[model samples]
Target: MADSITTIGFDADDTLWQNEQFFRSSERQFAAMLAPYFDGDDLMDRLLAVEKRNLQYYGFGIKGFTLSLVETAIEVTEGNIPASVIADILAAGREMLWHPVETLPHVTETLEGLADRYRLVLITKGDLFDQERKLAQSGLGDFFDAIEIVSDKDRSTYERIFTQHGDGPRHAVMVGNSLKSDVVPAIEAGSWGVFVPHELTWVLEHVDEPVSSSRFRRIETLRALPEVLAEISAAYSAA
Candidate 1:
């Protein structure tokens, strides 16, 4: 609600569209396929561990995720898995390539409402081709003034974006679903962060600490955004 704020950044993936559900469904299918070799819990644990370890080496995207699935499947089966099983896992990974391509509840309306007042930017990180495909299909693309598909979200990234836009952290706000990739870094960069939790946030995006800053708040749905933004604007004016 700071009066000086004229720019807002948005995270893609789970923020504006359905992303994690695809991964979750894929994981379920993977577990079902691997049940003959190991328990569901153990298999999931190994997959999670592999994903975490690979994030450092491969960053984020379908490539790394697919590789993790392949590696975990091979590891759990102890090299005894059939070629068909491997094919099934690879198919499951490819199935995650396309999502339903619909904006979250209120996301479109909120973006339209905010467009008149703020310079909106779509800032997301992931596989370039897949991310672009989703964005192109979203129909929400036109509302944004800029679209940045980055490799990661960190302080330097935020700084670079703001500088390029001729803005500063104090006058910027970041809205998204991931506490790790969106909210924490935005707050750390001295900007406001609004968290709209999705039903299936990735386990990797989970945060250990509570978000308790005055500059940070959480909303249950995207539909609540316009009113919340209005309140922020009003408060900024009052200050």
Candidate 2:
């Protein structure tokens, strides 16, 4: 018998609303603030390196990103970096924290349509307060049956979330823009992994598509989600 799907897991950043663009904007601002001390591309490379290393220390979100920026500045300048630059970086991070949450095309409509049919669970990774702020600001909070703000996304994370929120990983569908964080791990956890590509995914979140996975489905936008879900259901029933 085919396993029945009962839960739908959605990713917030970029999948439901605009997120990475703000970080990109802030990065350009950060580069300009330090141009006198470092080249733009070189500074960005250093900043990314620090971010990668600092993920274990600071985790994800604007706060960690700002800290990484400061660390990068201090490293490149050999500790002579100005306090004013650091202040500016902190201010930029605050701006990102307060930035408006602009939902992607068809996000609201699609979620509204699916909420009645499935147990919708939001699974996102980032700082707790910032993610909470974004969810409150987005006004999409009510549609979710449960919200999980985790430090990271992985197979075990999906297993736990799906089991708690609905049925189990085998009965869940995880949809998002990142192939790495949102897709691969969820697929490994025994859920359907649906990829909805976004234009400005962060470099660290990059990963190749799992086209050979029977549970993988790629859609152009959230508008196509219901149809995809129906198709998955049909496949499951026929199995």
Candidate 3:
């Protein structure tokens, strides 16, 4: 038997770099800004609701999130939200967009270690411009053989990407923080799904773990990736 995995796909936000923390920070600011308008209302929940409803219209990323914040503010205030407040909200969004990328611990070294051994791909879902900006600033762009900044992640998307970039999902491994977007679908696509949990993952992205799948593996961090891959290879070779 040959090696079970030949290609590796990585998720950008949270997995490779700091992402949801910024959103969390902005959300607290949004809630504080809206607090004076209405007392005891869960503004964060309202914002998340708007975000879910508007995902079709705006997709993901700071721009969409900013629009949702403004919409939530107006709705909560019954169209009485101040223009200055709205300006402040927009400014917050701009600040998030301009925020510098900070790669997670072990990301750079792990990517460098794996780059020589596997066909590496960056597969992430979000606003194209924002994703590209993060990737460019990450200084890890050259490590990947291909970069996929998709609108969403699904089994079909994984199948298409892995097949096109490598030998297909059977020979691929997708590592990321989201169980919904990164792990489950990649497993459904017949690839190994490596889950590396991130503390600040978005609530909407949460899903039950696919623990029963033989192709599924969970690691504490990206630093353990090579060891896990070796284990997978040995297990496959034995069978």
Give model 2's TM-score versus the native structure: 0.97
Q: What is the C-alpha lDDT of each candidate?
A: 0.84, 0.93, 0.93
Global lDDT of model 1: 0.84
TM-score for each model: 0.93, 0.97, 0.98
RMSD of 2: 1.2
Comparing 1 with 3 on lDDT, the higher-scoring candidate is 3
List ranges where model 1 is wrong by over 4 Å.
208-210
**Tens-digit per-residue lDDT, 1-239, candidate 2:** 14678999999999999999999999889888888877646777888999999999999998999899889989998998899988998999889989988989999999999999899999999999999998999999999999999999999999999999888899999999999999999999999999999999999999999999999999999999999999998998888
Question: Each candidate: RMSD to true structure?
Answer: 1.9, 1.2, 1.1
Worst 10 residues of 1 by lDDT: 208-217
Per-residue lDDT tens digits of candidate 1, residues 173-234?
A: 88999988888888888788889888888887989433578788788887877767777777
* Order of models, best TM-score first: 3, 2, 1
Candidate 3 global TM-score: 0.98
- Model 3 over residues 119-157: C-alpha lDDT tens digits? 999999989989999999999999999999899999999
Over 4 Å off, model 3: 1-3
